[model samples]
Target: MQQKQTPSALDRLKELLARAGFDWFLGALIGMILLAYLWPAPGVQEGPLSLGELANYGVSLIFFFYGLRLSPEKLQAGLSSWRLHLVVQFSTFLLFPLLALPWHALFKGGSNELLWLGTFYLAALPSTVSSSVVMVSIAGGNIPAAIFNASISSLIGIFVTPLWMGLFLSASTEGFDIWQVMGKLVLQVLLPVVLGIVLHRYWGAFAEKHRQKLRYFDQSIILLIVYTSFCESFARNMFRGYSIPDLLLLGLTMICLFFLVYGIIHLISRMLGFKREDRITALFCGSKKSLVHGTVMSKVLFPDANMVGIMLLPIMIYHALQLLAASVIAQSMARKAGVAAEGE
Candidate 1:
C-alpha cells in the first residue's frame, strides 16, 4: 500500500479558507476590481461591445432562470410556516432599514455620506436566495421555509427596495424619477421573471438540470457589472475621497452589522419558541443581502455609472463577511447537531 502523504501547510490554509467560504468567486470579485483599476477603458467603453449593455441583458436572464427554478408547489407547501415567514421578511425589509436609518444624520453633509447611502442601499436590499438556502441546508434548517422566505424576499424586494431608496435617492441622484425606475425594473427584471414562471412547466426542468451552468452565467454577469461599475468610478475618480482607513472601517462596520442582525434574529427566534431548524432558517435567511439585486438594480437606481461602484462597496463587503461568518456558524451547527444525534 502507498504511504499516505502528509498535508502541507499551504494545503491546510487552502482547506481552512474553503471552510470559511473564501472561494474562487470571491477571489474573482477582487480580481475584477483590480482589472477595473488597471484596464478600465474596456469596461467603460460604449457601443456594440459595451460590457454594461451585456450585463444588463444578463441580469434579465438571471432573473428569468430564477423564476424558472421556482416551484409553485414548494412555495405553496412552505406557506404553512406563516410566522417564520413574517419574521424573516420583516427582519430583512424593515429591521435592517430602521437600523441604518438613524445613522444617516451622522453621515449627512460629510465625506462619508456616500458610504452611508451605500450602507443604506445594502440594508434595503433583499435576502440572497442561493447562499441563504445553502447555508440553511448546511445548518440543518427548514429547507422549505428557507426556500420560501428567500424567494418571497426577492419578489418583495423588487418593489420595497425601490420605495426605500426613493426616500433618499431623489435628493442625491440626478434625474431620479421613481416612475421611470419602476418601469425599467418591470421591463428588465419583473417581466423576465414572469415570463420564466409562465414557461416553467416547459423549461423548469431544463433550468434545474443546468443550474450549475446557469450559476456560472449569473456570476459572470455579476463580475461584468462589478467591473463596469468600478471602471466608471475609477475613470471619474469617485474613489479618490476614500482612503484605506475608510475602507477598513466600512469592512468592520459590515461585520458588526451582520452579527447584530444575526444576534437579534436568534433572540427573536428563541422568544417566539422556534425549534432549532426554524431558528437556523430565520438567522441565515434574515441576515443576507442580495449582491445580485444590488448590482443589477444599481444600473437603474443610480443613473451615474460613477456612483455605482461606491454604491456597491458596502454590499460587497457585507456579502463576503456574511458568507464567511455564516459558513462557520452553519458548520458549527451541523457539527453540534451531529454530535447530539450520536449522543442520542
Candidate 2:
C-alpha cells in the first residue's frame, strides 16, 4: 500500500495564513502604502474622477452591501442573549475609551501626540463585524451573539464615535460643528445602509452568493482610501518628522492595547460566569476595533485628508496585530474544544 503524503511546511504556513486572513490582499495593503509614498500625485490631486470622490462613493457602496447581507432573523434571534450583548457593547464603547484616556494623557504633550490621537480614535471606533465573527466561529464561540454584537456595534459607532471625538476636537478647533458632522454621516453612511436593508429583501441572497467577490471589492475600496490619504500626507510632508523608532513604538503600543482590552474582557466574562462559548464571543467581539469604520469615518470626521494618514496609523496597526493575536487564540480554543469533545 502507498503511504499518505504529509503537507509540506510551506503549504502549512499558507494554510494557516489563509485561515487567519493574511492573504495576498495584505500584500496589496502594503503595496498601496508604498504606492502612496512613491507616486503620491494622482491619488492626492483634486479633480473629478479623483481618488477622493471615488473613495467617498466606495464608502457608501461598502455599507450598502453590508446592509444587504445582514440577516434580520439572525439579529432577532440574538436579542435573547441580552447579558452577553450588554457586556460586549459596554466593553467596546465604554471600557475601551476609559482605558485609552491614560494613554492620551501620557502622549498629549509629547512628540507622539498625533499617534496617541490615532490610538484614541481606534478606541472610539466599533468592533469589526466580519473578522470578529469569523474569529468567534473559528474558536467555537456563540456565532449568533457574535454576529448581533458586531453588527450592532457598527451602527452604534456611527453616532458614538463622532460624539466622542467632538468632545476633544471641538474644544481644540474653532468652527468645528459636531452636529454638521453627524448630519454628513447620516447622508453618507446611514442612508446607504438603510437603502441596502430595504433592497436586501430582493438582493440579499444574491449578495450572499457573491460574498467573497464583494469582500474583495470592500478591501479594494479601503486600500484606495488608504492610498489617497497617505498620498495627501506625503505631498504635504506631514510624515517628515517621524523616524523608525517612532513606528516601532506605535506598533508595540497597539499590541499592548489589544492584550489589555482582551484580558479585561476575559476576566469580566469569567466573573459574570459566562459559558465557554459566550465568553469567547464576548472576548473576541468586545476587544476588537473596526478598521473599516475607522477609514471610512475618518474621511467624514476629519476635514483634512493630509492629517488623516497620521490618524489612521494606530487603527491600521491594531487591525494587523489583533488579527494575528486572535488567530492564534482562536486556533488554541478550537483545539481544546476538539480534545474535550473527543474525551467525552
Candidate 3:
C-alpha cells in the first residue's frame, strides 16, 4: 500500500485560514486599499477606460448575473414561510436602523457625525445574499428560504436604502435630490436586474454554471471600487484627521452591533416559536449586511468620492467581522446537529 503523504505546513496554514474565513478575496480587499494609498492617480483618472468607469459598468453586470441566478421557482416556494420572511426583513431594515438612530444625537454637530452617518448607512442596507445563504446552509437552516429572503432584501434595498438616506443626506450633502438619485438607481441598478430576471429562462443555467467566475468578477469590481474610493480619499487627505484608535474603536463598535443584532434576532426567533432551522436562518440572515451593495450604493449616493471611502469603512469592518464570526458559529451548529443526528 502506498504511504499517506503528510500535509505540507503551507497547506495546513491555508486550511486554517480558510476555516477562519480568511480568504484570498478578503486579502485582496486589503491590498486594494493599500494600493490606493500608494498610487491614487490611476484609480482617480477620468476616462472611459479608467478604473472608476470600468467599475461602474461592472456593477450593473454583477447585479444582472445575480438576477440571472435567482430562480423564480425557488422564490415562489420560499414565500410560504411568510412569518419567517417578515422576521428577517423587519430585523434587517427596521431593527438595525432603530438601534443606530438613538446614537445620532451624540455624534451630531461633531467631528464624528460622518462616522455615525456611515453606521446608519450600514444599518439601513440589506442583508448580504451569498454569505447569508452560505452560512444558513452550513448551520442546517432553511436554505430555500434564505435564498428567497436574501434576494428579496437586495431588491428592497435598491429603493429603501436611498429613501432612508434621503432623510439625512439632504441636510449633509449639497445638491442632494432624492428624485434624481432614484432615477439613477433605476437606470444603473434596477433596470439591469429586471433585464437579467427577464432573461433568466434563457441564460440562467449559463450564469449558474459559471457562478464561480461571476463571483470573481463581482469581487474584481468591488476591488476596483475600493481602490478608486480610497484613492480619492487618499489624494484629498480625507483620512488625515482619523487616527488608528478611531479605526479600532469603529471596529469594536461593528462587533458589538453584530452581536446585538444577532442576539435580538435570536430572542425574536425563540419568541416566535421557530424551529432550529428557522432560528438559524433568522440569526444568520438578519444580522448581516451587504458589502457589495454598500460600495456600489456609495458611488451613487455620495457624489463626493472622497467621502465615499470613509462611508464604506463601517460596512467593510462589519463585513469582515460577520464572515469570521458567522463561520465559527455555523460550524459549531453544524457539528452539534451532526452529533444529535448520530445519537438518534
Who wins the TM-score comparison? Answer: 2
> In candidate 1, what are the lDDT values of residues 211-289, reduced to their tens digit?
8899889989999999999999999999887999999999999999999999999999999999999999999999999
Q: State the lDDT of candidate 2 residue by residue for 1-344, as single tens digits.
A: 99999987567545655765667876787888899999999987887788899999999999999999988888898999999999999999999888888767777767778787788889999999988888899889999999999999998999999998897778765656899999989999999888888898899999999999998899989999999999999999988888999999899988998998899898999999999999999999999999889999998998767788999999988888898888878877887899999999
Give the worst 10-residue stretch by lDDT in candidate 3.
Answer: 12-21
How do these models rank on lDDT, best leading?
1, 3, 2
Candidate 3: give its CA RMSD in angstroms.
Answer: 2.4
- Runs off by more than 4 Å, candidate 3: 1-22
Error of 1 at 329 (Å): 0.6
Clashes by residue pair, model 1: none
Candidate 2: segments with Cα more than 4 A from true spot: 6-16
State which candidate, 2 or 3, has the greater lDDT. Answer: 3
Return the TM-score for each candidate structure: 0.95, 0.96, 0.95
> Candidate 3, 30: how far from true, in Å?
0.9
lDDT of 1: 0.91
The TM-score that candidate 3 achieves is 0.95
Residue 126 lDDT, candidate 2, scale 0-100: 94
